[model samples]
Target: MAGSDSLFGFGKGPPALLLFLAGMLISNIGRSAYFVCVTWIALTWSNSARLVTILLFTSTLAQFLTSGVSGYFADMVDRRRLSVSLDVVRALVVALTGCAIAAKIGIWVLFLSVALYSVVDRGYLTAMQSMIPALSRRRSAIAANSASYLVMQAGTFLGALLAGYLLHTLPYGIGLFPIAIIFATSAVTLSAARTELSDPTHANSIYSKPRFQLRFMYHLGRHRLIAPTLIYSLGFGVGFLFSSLLAAYVLDEMKGGAVLFGQMESAWAFGAVLACLLLISGAGKLLADFGLAPLLFLSGTGLILLWMIPGPITAATLLVALGVIYNASRILMDARVQQTVGITEIGRTKGAINTAATGTGLLAFTFIAVAGDTLAPSDIFAQYGLLVIAVAAGFLLPALRGRPRSHDEDRSA
Candidate 1:
């Protein structure tokens, strides 16, 4: 009876929820630090931009390649234990990598180590996602995810904001300390959390040989849920890809450097934080229940404008608006995916969905950083905006066609 859902009325109580938020905040702080680490380290080491992007790409590429396998293992494994151990390993790996960089180790070795860390890091996240549904009851799923995302947005903004200051003031080697500390904290918190009650649903597996792998390709081809989710991911990723190129447009072509870039990222982060706050305050449920499609269309339209617009002030305004709407839509869609899919295929369902998004990012990064370098920024943004609009159309038209006769009605029917 003590282990039942009465404690929180629906799912986990205060203690488990606190731990969950802490874990996500710490993990996301590490991720945010790592995202900016490449450019910072490159500046300190006098490395090529290509090399920096290559290292970042190496990490994403490895994660993309292994994501499906990681998801499969997540469904089969003891996710909490797997998550805890991996965090510990990641902390040690990152600390050692930091030390090596401080000592001026071979660049190739540094890259290889970071790549190895990426695999572990992403693998742990996959396991964690699989575990969340187990830790909390079904009714609390949305709250849990919203809380996690809020923490993540805060952590990411704080990390990136601090990194900007630290790279200027502190030595690059010393800058990695915060990342190490966060992962260490995450490891400790998760290990302690293991002593709590294990939910019954997740208790049955020590690697069940689910028909997942055997029937994976067939399910992917036939599943109504998976196909639409992939397309939606593609649309979102394309929008983000265009946004990434927009940054280059501002810095190089707009003739504004650090000052403009800093302003834009800060504005973008602020909007994200404000949006998350609104969601956690119960405003999001109102929006979700009432204006889902119109809001989505607004987000897409905002992204299109954000990409094509010139001038730092104007573009930043558009980006702030776009970022908020985009994140809100993402949260809604992700929840829908979980609700729509068969429980047995959750891992592959999400993995297939994620794969397309991350892959699109890789493609976009490669194209923008490489081709945008050769072309005019105006031309790049113009072309990129068109591409994003085209992708968004695929999602928008169908949803409209399937839209309920009234706002109060469910769109899924």
Candidate 2:
């Protein structure tokens, strides 16, 4: 009975948790649906992988530009209102995009719409993460995060499947209507949730000094456990890179069509969803007990293995393995950060980490996009896997090094 509050450590079955999960599920569904539609359109129009990369690049650029400022606002404003507002903004953007597509707008309009959506989405995610500490007890934060992540994975899986099916059967413009409706519904659900926003003790004084924000980030990186954790999290970007290349990889390398690509995406997301469920059910503690370094190393190995497999069945199997290891490692690292950082500073700290990580991802994507003109996706994926393994090894060495003894102890002997 002790940990039985609403089945995921949400205290006493509050409406807020239900509302949050609903919003996350609907929002992810819309995002995935739109992504499938847009990517299909880009590929069809240009018939080139480079164009798809450029579209993804636009999204990464938007995240890079907005992450820092979004984090700042998330800490300063009421998170609940900010979350709802972002959803509303996204709904409007999606609706406008649908209209543009219906009227035979150019590809540039599509790119601009995606970029704008990414900016708002970055803010929405930061606000949502910031809300967790206020919504649950410290002991229950892991469960809360796991539950939310599970919903996200499930939504992505279903959304991709739905998008693939609908796109194959219906016209492109009509495919976007469902996505707009989903975004609007997400806004409505999030707006109905109740949350308490406590004023930060040092808000005015700290925020008044622009220099403090930079100093705060510097201090966070200097923390021993947190620093390593952040470094480990950089590997997460490689997973995104893989996703960006997946459609092209499936089409060009495997000679697969839209349906096969959707199945692959769904398979990866299903693996992640299973992992989240395991974590929420208390299996994460078992994995964390083995330490983050080993898990990361294994995840990198799994990614590397993905390139070696030839058949679709084998590749899909590797995707599932990679998804499990990748997401489990991420959840553990996130829980570590949440536990170490104070509640008030969580937004800023998470924002800084996300920005750095996204910036690194942007650079990687740019390199990959440029390289895509000549090199194959398999080669790019192989290089990314190697980079991840090397980074993991670098981090593992320091962690494995035993702590030094004090000089006074040796002198006593």
Candidate 3:
């Protein structure tokens, strides 16, 4: 019954916990569509690889440098106000980006606006993540996280579809209408969530002393922080490489075009949605730590196989499997973080974790920049595969011996 309660998100928090989840799904739809439009427009407008790279790199770089600070603010501020304000900011930014495109604005303007949008996006996510524990008990937190990510992934797929439809059939400026509306809806929906998310310990103590205080350092060293951090870094970093290389893989290796590429993306996003669905089931607790190592190993094997897999149909099918494996790993790892940390520390813990993951992502991008020209897309996929397998190997021993102790356990020892 407890598991069932958690599965449905009927925890100790306000009823608006359900509202929070709904807002996540809705906003993500807009977020995903807006990014797709930005990327597509940038490529169409510039037709320059260097410019596109600069745009994307700016967004990633902003996250790498400031995720920690954003998380810090997420913790210190009233999370409800912080999150709702960020949602409004996002809506405004998305609308503004659309206007820039419609008006034929300077490329530099697009760059600056998207970079600012990028910063706000990361901060909004950190604030929302920190709110999960603030709204639920441990069991409920896991299920809620699973639910949260499920909708978010589904939103991504929906948004991609919306972008494709609008781009293919409608005028360019039409995209501005729906995105702004979606985010505004999200802001209104989430604002109704009543909860006290700020930590008094943080506000009152010397530990609250701005960024990188002694308090954060102490939590940074803990295993609770380390576990999720490593998992996120590997999953996100490798996943980003996959997204970047996938187009080339489709074009060159599979001899496919936009149609096949779209189909493959659908399959992958579908897999992620399916993963979250399974994770939110009655067996949610078992789902969090279950099969994580094996999932990574399987992901590596699939990536390696792509090095030789030849058919577009076959490639798309394989992506379905890989998507499930990769996203399940991400969702479960996120749940583990929520399980291990308390309301007060979850913000900074997540911030540090995201910083590490972004650093890993940037490193992956650097590797591509430096070596991408010489390597075939297949070769890059195999290299990423090897990295995943290596991470899996490291987890293999610990997984077999049984789940390692959390930081709290070490402290009690």
Candidate 4:
């Protein structure tokens, strides 16, 4: 997968590939900025653990609602054009959000902007998800995915680092305006990436026959592997989103204010970076071939262990270790699924996964919100840990009895 044939099925050179990679880099940066900015804003506005959980959960809920529609359109329409358009749309939304925040807009307006941003951002990502298969060979699919994940994760790590530094040096909310610029740059870069038609026969225009039907979603949910994979994915999402609130948790319980919390977040960012690197070096592939279920189960277990730690050093170490399994399972499982499902159903399946993930996240967040109000911090983690264990058991039992022999043989053979 080195030459133009590797880059595009049509033997178009490496320039487009480079451009595509660059585009993803910037997009990931914008996404990372929003994550950091939003979490910081929530922390500043309200210290209640429940409020933070709801805010975080609401963002994903918005995406879950739109992911199906976006995936439908991505597969049905001209994926490349749709991808670029979504990026531009994301830039405009981010810019408006920055302007609104700077002008002291109402809290509702800010919330709306954040919600809208999540939809557009995920819409573009869904498009990009479909495009990876379209742009590469069958064997190259995993490689392209791995490369994209690495780039995306690296961008996020850097963006979070940069944003955290800015927050420390400048006044509060200053990072938003600069983050808008990053989104704008991403949109332009993505648009500039030439979309060589996959089929030499198809026209290179944006307008295409619109295909909308409820069956796409229905069929997606009905697929044997996809449906079960999605259930497992939902569990994974719940654990990940729950763990992400650790920063706020630390601020409240660990005697660390904003500054110390930021540092811990930076640690999380670096941990993610390390995890991505490990996956890119074949750790993910190994896990996919060996024990995806156990890996995922342990990932959740790691989250529980991390929360149970008494000191910062041990907590940080566990957090980083948790990060490793979390991302490793994600990369490997997604790659395996994509390879198994093939390109035809990629969008539908990916959309289903996204929808389930977002939906699960929303439910978990809602629960956390209610629990946050009533339970002590330690109690909240303890209860969530139990939930994670139950979910992990669900996946582990299935893996033991119903391994993806059909899917694995297809990939291996």
CA deviation > 4 Å runs, candidate 1: 1-10, 43-53, 106-110, 197-211, 214-223, 235-263, 283-300, 342-344, 369-372, 376-381, 398-413
Model 2 backbone overlap count: 0
What is candidate 1's CA lDDT for residue 83?
A: 80
Best by lDDT: 2
Alpha carbon lDDT at 92, candidate 3: 88
**Residue pairs in clash, model 3:** none
Flag the better candidate by lDDT, 1 or 3.
3
The true-versus-predicted C-alpha distance at residue 408 of model 1, in Å, is: 19
TM values, all candidates: 0.80, 0.90, 0.85, 0.85
- What are the lDDT figures for the candidates, one per model? 0.61, 0.73, 0.70, 0.63
C-alpha-based local distance difference test score of model 2: 0.73
Better of 1 and 2 by lDDT: 2
lDDT of 1 by residue, 312-358 (tens): 77877876776676566555555555555555555665666556666
Ranking by lDDT: 2, 3, 4, 1
Model 3: lDDT to the true structure: 0.70
Ranking by TM-score: 2, 3, 4, 1
Put down candidate 4 lDDT per residue, 1-413, tens digits, no spaces.
35555642213356666767788898888787677766776666666666667667767788878877776676666766776777777777766776776677755655687688888887788777676765656554445566677777778767767667766776545667677778778768766765553222142223222343334455344444553455356446634454446656677567776565655655655565676676556565565565555555565566566557656777667656665665555556566556666455566667777777777777777777766757655555555556667765665564568765444222321
